[model samples]
Target: MLTTSTRLKLQNICSRLAQGEFVSLQERVYLQKFAERDRSVSTWVSRAQRFQREGTQQGLDGLMADLDLGRRNPDDPEHPEDDLGDWFSNASPWLRRD
Candidate 1:
């Protein structure tokens, strides 16, 4: 568990991490937990909402494109089967650095 301040800091760090921004070692320590959590439907809904708000100009297509870009590396261990629901349920968007 993290303190409220720590949680806020972690979210900030994650936002930066998703943008291909730099993060310090301290941020990495706190963010590692995102990799351990279960990715539920609500999680994808929340991410979708965030994308709708922040990337509305591109709409859902943009959202899908971002998802594709996120999973683009041939080295990535997981791939979407039907929709991105599987990947979204298994991984945390906060952990994506691309």
Candidate 2:
């Protein structure tokens, strides 16, 4: 349901979070813009913002833990394959998706 540009932004945000780096302007914009419509993405954005303000990597670490736990998506039909979550699960926990 996300546009190409938005998808790119999401990918970039996930990458930074995965790397334990701070989120960027474009990533913030993506989160804010999509928060209303996407609960998963919003949750991630909320955690990111909270951890940032608290001055800790707890949120990022938590995200890594979630990734390691793996996840299941009932929304996307093309799953267990090229879906973003599947890609992350198959590859790197640092890489994230929503």
Best by TM-score: 1
Q: By lDDT, who's the top model here?
A: 2
Q: Quote each prediction's TM-score.
A: 0.41, 0.36
lDDT of 1 by residue, 33-81 (tens): 5535624322433344345345443777676655643433334457443
Candidate 2 to native Cα RMSD, angstroms? 14.6
The reply for model 2, stretches above 4 Å from the true place, is 43-98
lDDT of 2 by residue, 1-98 (tens): 87888767775685566456887777667667787788766666545444443334357656754453332332447654345655577875566554
Least accurate stretch of 10 residues (summed lDDT) in model 2? 65-74
How many residue-pair clashes does candidate 1 contain?
A: 0
lDDT of 1: 0.53
